[model samples]
Target chain A: MSIDKLSGLRVLCVEDDPDIRAIAELALGDVGGFDVKLCASGAEALSVVDDFQPELVLLDVMMPGMDGPETLRALRAYESLQSTPVIFMTARLQPDEIKEYLALGAIDVIPKPFDPMTLGEQIGGILDRHSGTTGYR
Target chain B: MSVNDVQASLVALRSKFSGRAREEILFLSRQAEKMSEGKLTGAELSEAYHVLHRLAGSAGTFGLPDLGEAARVLEKSLKPHVERLAATGVADDAIAPVEPLFLRGIEGLFGLVTDQPASVPDSQNKTVEGVDDDSHGTQVRILVCHQSADVRLSLVQGLARYGFQCLEVSLTSPDLAGVIAESSRVASVFVVGEQQLEGVASECRSQNVGGRQLPVLCLAGHDSFEKRYWAAEAGAEGFFSEPLDFPRLADSIERLVSERRYRLSGRVLIVEDDSDLAEHYRLVLESSGVEVRLVSDTRHLMQDLAEFQPDIVLMDVNLAGRSGITLARLIRFEPRWLSLPIIYLSSEDDPESQLVAMSEGADEFLSKPITDDYLVRSVLHRCHRARQLSELMNRDSLTGLLKHALVKQQVHKELASCRRLGYRSCVAMVDLDHFKQVNDTWGHGCGDRVIKALANLLKNRLRETDVIGRYGGEEFVVVLPGCDVGQAQSVIEGIGRSFSELLFFGNDEDSFSVTLSAGIAALNDFSDGDVALEAADQALYQRKSAGRNGVSVYTVPE
Candidate 1:
């Protein structure tokens, strides 16, 4: 059941932590009921961007080489991914920081230590709110 | 991803990731040691922070909150100096404080690695489902306050359809207020045929407690006037007869509990010249439940900082006529915006210029044509880190309570609130009796445990809204926002009694109980928080002069 929070949604998750990555995988794929792709790092995520053609990118804030925001910038280089909603999943939550993430073009910031059970709902809720907005894939 | 599958995956990942997580901390610590010895280059210092940064961000998620927390503190403490070195090519003089912090982080990891007993496997702590404390915001909990077990069970089942899957409390639970306060915000409280609703009712109506307001409804077998009157008098918002208008009741519960509002979703102010790119960014941010404002002109950024109050700044290094680095530096010039994160979006990949921009006050430098994911993640991390560091600065390193100044400030705010609301508030001064002797006799480690035990007692005993602060080395001050002198004294006395009962172990084969003395002052007795504090301190002094382990109230001097 691929629910239509954002129409025909496909999500690519990039995280360095394997545990978090797996949790996100389940949250996005199983609980969220969406077409999902998981990548270990920003570099791997960038390599598969065109092939996966995800409508949204769920990224981790901290990574080994090219971090999440750097990867977000790289994703925008592709003509196909310019307007995609990028959500950052991070353990670090300070209100100002969330605002900063927004300033950086991320549609949302998901606090890390995220609940796998409600993770899908949280993402879907964000998608549902933004679903009506124009110019979003 | 069923819940079970997610849990299974978590259990599996725990085993896989722990070894690597250890390596991650060890590597960062090694770099930190190198930096301490003045060996790491400026680039290496920045690199060290990033590696620790990743570890800090992930360690908590991997069932190692202690390691994650240590890494977080280490990352934040090292960041400013690292940024300074990255920018100015400054030597290692600024890094004097960083080495110890790095060593401390390494020590925390080492503690984690060595803590497991020989008999227990590593897998025991790794299971997500096993931890009683881990509530991951999954099942919906409804606290059922009924005097009958069968009725409680039935009501629990009735609400199951609407997704109130877990029953937090039943008829046997003595204090509904305590249960509700202890649990992660119960969705609703259904009081079935109960006459006295004092505990939960006080909790539900109280603005001072600060727990999420749960709708309280009463259901009785008879629609008698006395029952309805009692329910109304008891502060039940809704009353239902035996047949139980289930639909109407469900509607009320939904209206009260499920209509939860979004709390502080991210807000952004974009300072970029590219109109199309700005629009794209705005849409993306807005879609993810973020509030976005675009300003192509950089002339009035101070005004925007006041109004929009962005957590992170996203601007191009080369803007229209004005350099983004210059703007970043200007922003940092103001004390209020010093910690405001600024991420520079530039097309250049040159490391030297990046360092210059960083030196100029940019928190991060992202090359242009940045992927949507990369841009978002950087902004998020910078913003979060800045906020966390500021928060950490306000907290005590030992007891994890508010620092002295913050406690006094909180008392001032609460006293002002007490005046406006015309409610009684009280301040308490808590001091351990014969603490120095305990420290001298049992050594500092045992003394520390005794201090921590008291703090934990205060946290457990006090309400969430009540402000607690570590006022001194062995003293704590608590501001009870809405508590009168009597209520405050009883609460303090309860803590004192419990603390005296607690047994703290000494160095070898000896263990002894620690007793604490407390003094309470009412807001009405003094003009401000400081004055109230002085009165409380005086009362505390009196308690110490008399037999210890007693709680004394301040009397107004004529």
Candidate 2:
């Protein structure tokens, strides 16, 4: 089944920096009503991703251990996660980098220094677009 | 958790990290003291860099802005020594330039190390994500993840003199190895610390599987054969040892990263009625690794474009029974070809003709009589810029595949061509099976790796005439012109089988693979591009519903 919105989705938010991770949690979990499980590094995310059974993975491109792309590569190895969508959230999501993520099967890229208040909408919009739905972008 | 609860946790967390930050800063200061007193060596310097880098990255976050700035200064001072150490495996001897600045940074940092401030500094009140305080703005960024602050500083300062942007990340960054592999902005990485050297080097190697691998240079304690051999085993491009040579190391770094990034390879399309001139132009460019395709007939320009898809077009302003300006304008009318550069080559060196050519969508006008060297350079540079700009506009950043909208336009163009000319063309919609599971099981990064692996495999295996594009999510659309249903299926099936067999590692140990489903719609079976695309989509849906990881061709119902 295709998912279209951020609400009620179990998400794995992977980032290296503690501050950024906390903010992402607040934006995704508290503000957007997402079930967000935060990881401090790509390695930690990899260790917990299968058990978490997250519907979506929100990754920070430049994380510590496995990095976003590496983590995505690792996740693809598991048969159970081959269909799950991954969205990259990074400060360095420039045009070229976004292409890199898209090539890696990232649903979309959310630029860094995001507005916490509207992150839910941005994420939802991308997911909705991904699932071929339209409404509250 | 509530936003308020998370915010409160963040506040409390800041203080906790602040305590550790102060201790780390104090220890880093002690290393600086030793370096100042001339006790610097390869091993000792590497450790200091690690501490200082951690301080620089964390101090600003833990409520000590001034300390972070000072660490930045000190890191800059050590840049040259760091680059030299990692590139050659030797810690190059360095005369600290602007020693007062390093001393000043050390003094300022001591204030923070000795006493934890009650309030966070205003300058770093926000996340360091947008902080732009560094003066090295013009240099190409060269990141140094080292163990010694002094070593990184010397290396950075030396690199700064040679126009390199220096960024320092902590030794504990899990993705330190990947920074070069993932980020295009990072020209190279200088790693000095001994701990995790092998792991970091391996990560660098792993990230470089598809694209240009980031050059990883390790800083070693000695120039021993055993040490170099170990470094090579760990996937380091080169190891710079202590008591190193700075200039030569700098040159080596440039040769490895910057010089390679700037290497020229392009395909130029030459449209000149003069067969001799076109071959001459093609020959000149071919020598420099630039592929050249010539079109002597003006009428077949569009057909050639659809086939070759060259980086830049070299056209004569005057064509046999046609105007070059008219052709250029027609090319620009199509959305897919909007940025396709058309350089007018004309013997009519008149300003009026050049102005007219420019107005009608020509990029450059080379006068009738031009030297081979000038023509080659002009064509190379134009093609290079066109490719770069095209990547920014038409290509997706990650896989370097054509964008969704751009792909659709390409599909339409290929369909129109098939309709006009009696040639068979196939539109194949490809989707990766269980792609989302790849994201959930490993992470987005792995999912991306699978996607990229598939994309690269497709590009490598498929013919150049086949236009491939990422049509969002795990879906891709390929326009295989001049190929029938059977031919397209055979080609796609081979690609799908090869892709699944390709090994994708989950970690140090776990490796897996993925498969793709292809649905082919013969253009001749449909009325238009959209209908053909829909037929392909329906075919894809049928395959997905009936167990995926296979190809199904669409057949017109009687």
Candidate 3:
């Protein structure tokens, strides 16, 4: 069975930097043609996840308070989002750090300075592979 | 929305980011001052780290890669101090050892932010000198003076296909010399019929654009030895026979125009420990319009090489402690820089020592106590020759683009940069659609015209930073740094549409158009350059199978 393309897929992005957030908005919303909800912090992302029912989460690794990992732990408490895939974006991605993120249940890790034009498609590709292994809906 | 709209928005967004970056730098500098004064808190140090981290992560995306790199370096150095401060809840004593370093780093970052003169988007700023106009945003113009209106019309229309906008210079003009002189400032080349060749050529010969003679190409009524001789005597740089072959004529004009453009000054890196001697070399080279960078510390030589990308290296035979020969060998250890010319400066007149230095990767040895004139002449000559040799080795002669191996190597370098700096880039594989049919239908000449046309189009449209290569017979590879596959697809599609509109003349009176197909793969997704290129090729195959003349991004099959 082939997974469908991720066009119009709902995604929640959590990033603290306003400039990067604005860039992500243009990349995912205008370029990627995805339904993207941007949150300024992990706390805001947790608040919006249930209502938005996003298919995927893009979490920045570092934030002022309640960072990415803690946010992921908090996010898993939601029953609907438990199985939803999450990807971490970070500036530093050492091999061990990647292992740690994967161990924390991140489907993939995207480095910072990501091409805004292809961010949505990259996430879609990540999701397709993740679903292939887990037989996710 | 169109790709242009997206690109425009990105430019706007980048300017906004730059403005914000200025304010952020100010905030960081204030924090640095507080730290230096021993009044900063642990939380404030953490804040400074985050600011630097954010700058490192996003500056390149906003078209400030150098600034981003500097920030990354600073962040890496500050990471340990920040972590220790967080653990100990003490900032002043913990950071006292590196306070001066932090202050200098912040000052450097501030310099980088302020040094740039109101940033113009890279695309707009990097138009090739001879090909584009800053005011009109149009192709290089050619002044055409022909006796017959029909011939002028044909010439104008034919040259338009080759990206030249021809302005008609009527033979009936009262002041032909004045007209030619005035137009010579804007036009790159003059294409005149044999009837008016002598007058126009003479006027053009007397005219100079930026101190170089304006080129004139003569269109002869028929091919003859006397006509060619006369044309050459009349100051025409190029001669084309009647029944014009547009491709060949345009090719000649292009070459002449490029040759008329000023050649860039050679850059030389001087690695000398003697401060006085280094300053002397710098002054002498600078007077001759040579860009000179001096390095006193041998430890930073590699970093300097990577940053400056000089055309040649001038080193002293004896450093304070390090041997110049050993340093030359160390530079040659990297395969990428093996071709760089290294000239040693030494007072050692022994032929045996000079030969020893030459064997250890030194290209030439210049004895000390040399006059400034000798130094300038030798360095400039060597720099020019080295550049010429490298271009011959690494570029495809037809397209003036990187050869397949060099482009592949570029992909690997960009991928490694992406991994280290957390940036994203894309590799695109482009092939002309139905190119075989084009060759069979027209001829090899027309086929070559199509290839050259596409190459010119790519060069005109893409950013200067993008690496374009002639990968195969009719296939080209373009590596776009800091672009996603989506953006690459859009850009390639735009090129494809423009390419299909281009007209190529066949042997007969008729002209035909050709189309191109392209596929893009995000560089960071694949493990290496070869794998990424293969994936892009696979996508190209898929596009060809789906009917050509389109762009596709590589997607994984679930």
Top-lDDT structure, candidate number = 3
In model 3, pairs of residues that clash are none
lDDT of 1 by residue, B1-558 (tens): 345555666656655666777676677678767866778777777876776777666655555544565566566656556766767777546555335545655655654431221111122222212111222122334556667667666665555433334343543557554445433232345454564366667666762232346656787777889988988888787888655443345445544443332221456778888766776666445433355678866888888889898767887777878888888889888998887778888897999978877988977777888765565555555655654565578877656689999999998988888888777789999999999999999898778777766765565455556789999989999988756788688767866776676555584356688899999999866677788899999999999999888899999977
Mark the regions of model 2 whose C-alpha exceeds 4 Å error after superposition. A1-137, B1-375, B413-425, B481-487, B555-558
Residue B226 in model 3: shift from native, Å? 3.6
Over the stretch B1-558, how does candidate 2's per-residue lDDT look in tens digits?
A: 654665565456556656666676667666666667766677777676666655655454444544564565466456556767888897644523323334555566654432322231122222122111121121244656667778777776554433344666566655554344323332454544455577666666665532445667777767888988888888777778764434335545655653354445788888888766675566456544477788877778888998889998988877778888889998887887887888898888789868977988988898978876687688778877886787778788766789999999888899889888877889999999988888998898878767766665555455555698999888999998877788688777866766665556666567677888989999877767888999999899988988999999987888
DockQ category of candidate 3: incorrect
- Descending-DockQ candidate ranking: 3, 1, 2
Rank ordering of all candidates by TM-score, starting from the highest: 3, 1, 2
lDDT of 3 by residue, B207-276 (tens): 5532446788899989999999999999888888867876678777767765553253688999998876
For A1-137, candidate 2 gives per-residue lDDT tens digits of 11233468998888877766665676677766788899888788778977899888888776556788999999888887898999987643347888889999998887654545446666776776576542211
RMSD of each: 23.5, 25.8, 13.0
lDDT of 1 at B453: 66
Candidate 3 local lDDT, A42-126, one digit each (tens): 9999888878998889899988899999999999999998988899999886789999999999999988767565566556656
Q: lDDT (0-100) at residue B519 of candidate 2? A: 95
Clash counts for the predictions, in order: 25, 81, 0
Q: Give candidate 3's root-mean-square deviation (CA, Å).
A: 13.0
Residue A102 of candidate 3: its Cα lDDT? 96
True contacts kept of 3: 0.37
Please name the candidate that would achieve the greatest DockQ relative to the true structure.
3
